[model samples]
Target: PKEDRERRGVTDGLLRLSVGIEDCDDLIADLRQAIERSARR
Candidate 1:
């Protein structure tokens, strides 16, 4: 499965997100914060 996914251009850095009923600005801020936090690691 990993080989197939790689062949199809899917990799470890891929992020699949599903937005719920939250406000767009809230979601964006949350995502930005998460990315920034991860980057610090």
Candidate 2:
């Protein structure tokens, strides 16, 4: 994953999750999907 574009609170090896009070299920699903996508290649 790439570093966040907005760098105010970002660190060198940070993995930021921009969840604005969204549903926990959705957030977890999205993370799982992303992890699978990243692991595929």
For each of the candidates, give the backbone clash count: 0, 0
Writing each residue's lDDT as its tens digit, candidate 2 over 13-36 gives: 668667788899998999999999
Model 2 compared with the native: what TM-score? 0.60
Candidate number with greatest TM-score: 1
TM-score of each: 0.70, 0.60
Off by over 4 Å in 2: 1-11
* Best lDDT among the predictions, by candidate number: 1
- Candidate 1 lDDT at 3 equals 92
Compose the digit string of candidate 1's lDDT tens values, residues 1-41: 99999999898789989898999999999999999999999
Identify the runs in model 1 with alpha carbons over 4 angstroms from their true place.
7-9
For candidate 2, the 10 contiguous residues with the lowest summed lDDT are 1-10
